[model samples]
Target: MAADGLDEIDYGILHLLQQNARSTTPVDMAEQLPVTDTTIRNRIDRLEEEGVIEGYVPIVNYEKAGFPIRLQFSCTAPTKKRHQVAGQALELPHVVKVDEMLSARENVQVLAVAKTTEEVNEITAGLDDLPLTIERESLLREERRRPFGHFGQHVVDD
Candidate 1:
């Protein structure tokens, strides 16, 4: 292990997994690293057990899936109750993601997807019921994500 606790092997596993978890195989990862396939599997198991490797989720294109309306709501909640408010926000039907921020104002960020304006209103109503102040709301145009860079060596495009 390196001084930071995770050595090159661990970081390689994380990088490959993050790149494409569904298509990644232990054998494929082992082929890239110096370890065997069994070692790759064992390392993945240990990472999961240690909570370093959390559950994987698919990135859905809501616009193509018929839920074209994507909304982002910035909200403010009592600092002491921010976590609970975020959890409650997640319970709403259209709400997909809730972020609890560490700040005085706009401490909560909510992302919701809906098929129509009514569903959006329903989400807004549900949030209104909570002890939060809706600061601003905007329609999301597009979003993109990539794996953490420091976790592994950067791969150049061909």
Candidate 2:
């Protein structure tokens, strides 16, 4: 394991889980990795205890689910209020993710889904009510999407 407690095997397990969290069992992982089922289970348990593997979630295709419009908003707020503003954004409906950015121009990023332009405007209006200045807004046009693979690759290389 590295100084932070996660080693190459741990990363590989994480990657396999990320690719298919619901059905990828430790036994299945052991077949592909150089570890036994008991080792896989032990590593996963340790990783969970260390909070490296927070939780499992299903990846949803919002566009296919009728939420076609993807709105991205970048807001600027004081460093002290960044977390507060991000929290407020998280409470907004349809918000998928809210992050605090460290850059000067933009300090908060909000990603939300909407079914129509009016819904997008409504979401924007709500964000405007927060104690932050909206710096930029864009409608995302996703051209490609895939599962995360870098973590597994890094582990193998290490």
Candidate 3:
């Protein structure tokens, strides 16, 4: 839905950052892209302004950062009330994020982080009596996303 000449450059930057988000700096990217530093800065600014690039978030080793186990709940709420229930479910303090996905090929899941089993239960408890039905509750001890370095190793690495 969005168009930009610098899309590939943006993707290249993101690809490099996927392995280590802090790996490259703007100046380095400017040099690598062979574009003026101002151009690089302006491109990043434009991406941010359009919300194409959200705020940079550090991927804390949540497991190492005191939350060893995480809970992911797959929910199936009534079609009409999905929005309302999703709002309430995500409002719980321990609830980190809630995703409402559609389509037959897709799956719905809620990821919650907790320091202990009690915290996980507390989060789940808060979801009780919601419009959604709990289809599955999967607990993952260690989880990670396969880094999608689309541009591969050509991008600079820190």
Candidate 4:
């Protein structure tokens, strides 16, 4: 509703959608958020147009889907080849997410899931072969991840 940034209603709509994007409709959000359905629809369209709402994705249980090993890799590359190396990592098997970091030491963060440690090693080996990759530090994820939420905690209702 504001020219510069999101307001209370916008944040509330986002919160409800984040909780359950697939089932949450504008009508349902309007009932819970004290806004009209038309308002909700407008806000959502604005959010999408502004790229705030990128896209929706289904949450998968990787462990139950036969991929239990979760690995995190922090990698660094030369400034010239940083983007090239990161793009190459995305094409590797089991690579789920690849993020570019601002830090000087490690500029790339990769999240991968595999069915076994062997698969993790294979993925790492493929990454290591890339040119300009200076260093890589990996860790196995142990804790169970909770569902995505908590974004609304910082939003104040008007």
Candidate 5:
């Protein structure tokens, strides 16, 4: 949470934007917030500049958008080979994020942002070929979104 002038009203504005940034005009917000349009605009500007607000993004349902599969895999790789495996994983198709875990004992949970079920299977196959053990796997059949659930927003390039 940002401490700079971030009060309840600021949070409210953020909530509104999360659902849709262009939902309310400054004039519309002024009527409800008891603040001027300039105030709202200036605050938004400051939020963007301070890196509190990132960018507007259209929420797309992964399934509807042809990304019919979501897979989470936990596996283990050597500490020395962590960098090498991580680098290669990033280039694999349908991979979204690979995170290193300190408490994993000897495993890492990777949220593969795959485009399809086939892609997910292929990625898993490739990873399986290595000396890594797959601990857990999950298929994301839906794209979940809250009404206004953005704590922070940044540019998401599709």
Candidate 6:
């Protein structure tokens, strides 16, 4: 095993997959790492089976997909009911993401997308009905993500 119980090949696979899962194939990873395509395939399967890879999902452009209004809701949930409140918030139709924070003041954060201000108002109303207190709500301009750098570059035999 490599650092953090994952082998170097695993890290390489994770790095490449994070960079571009759609374009990065086992063969591509093999050419970069000191392993065969079969090895890469098997490793990916194992990683998924072990619940590390989780799931492969497309990063959709909500605005382009007819949801131009993006909003973030910051809320304070009762400490003991944070998880429950988050789950309830996530169940709301426009809600796309819910995060439970460590801070008690603003513990629940919800990301929602809508096609119109009416829909945005509806989402806000739904959240307000929940067991949490809405602290702040703001429009989301954009979001960017990238592979974790600690996953590192391609592994080479030293």
Please report, in order, the local distance difference test score of every candidate based on alpha carbons.
0.90, 0.85, 0.69, 0.77, 0.68, 0.89
Q: Give the TM-score of candidate 2.
A: 0.87
10 residues in a row with least lDDT, candidate 6: 149-158
Top lDDT: which candidate number? 1
- Tens-place lDDT per residue, model 3, 1-158, is 22644456667666655655576667777666646668767877887887867888876677787777778888887766676767787887777778877732213467788997788778777776666667788887776676765643454433
- Name the 10 consecutive residues with the lowest summed lDDT in model 5: 149-158
lDDT of 1 by residue, 1-158 (tens): 88867778888888889888999899888778778889989989988998998899899999999999999999999999999999999999989999999999999999999999999999999999999999999999999999897775542111
Greater-lDDT candidate between 2 and 4: 2
By TM-score, the best candidate is 1
Model 5: number of clashes?
1
Give the lowest summed-lDDT range of ten residues in model 3.
149-158
- The deviation in Å at residue 108 for candidate 4 is 0.7
Which scores greater on lDDT, model 1 or model 6? 1
Error of 1 at 10 (Å): 0.4
Which regions of candidate 1 deviate over 4 angstroms? 154-158
Off by over 4 Å in 6: 154-158
Error of 2 at 90 (Å): 0.8
Instruction: Tell me the lDDT of candidate 2.
Output: 0.85
Order the numbered candidates by lDDT, best leading. Answer: 1, 6, 2, 4, 3, 5
The Cα error of candidate 1 at residue 136, in Å, is 0.5
TM-score of each: 0.95, 0.87, 0.78, 0.80, 0.63, 0.93
Clashes of each: 0, 0, 1, 0, 1, 0
TM-score of 4: 0.80
Pick by TM-score: 2 or 5, better one: 2
Once model 3 is optimally superposed onto the true structure by TM-score, how far is the C-alpha of residue 42 displaced, in angstroms?
0.5
**Can you write out model 5's per-residue Cα lDDT over 1-158, one digit (the tens) per residue?**
35666765576567656656767777766665656789989978887997879987776566676766678787777777766776666666676778776653445667666665577679888778765677778776654557655532322211
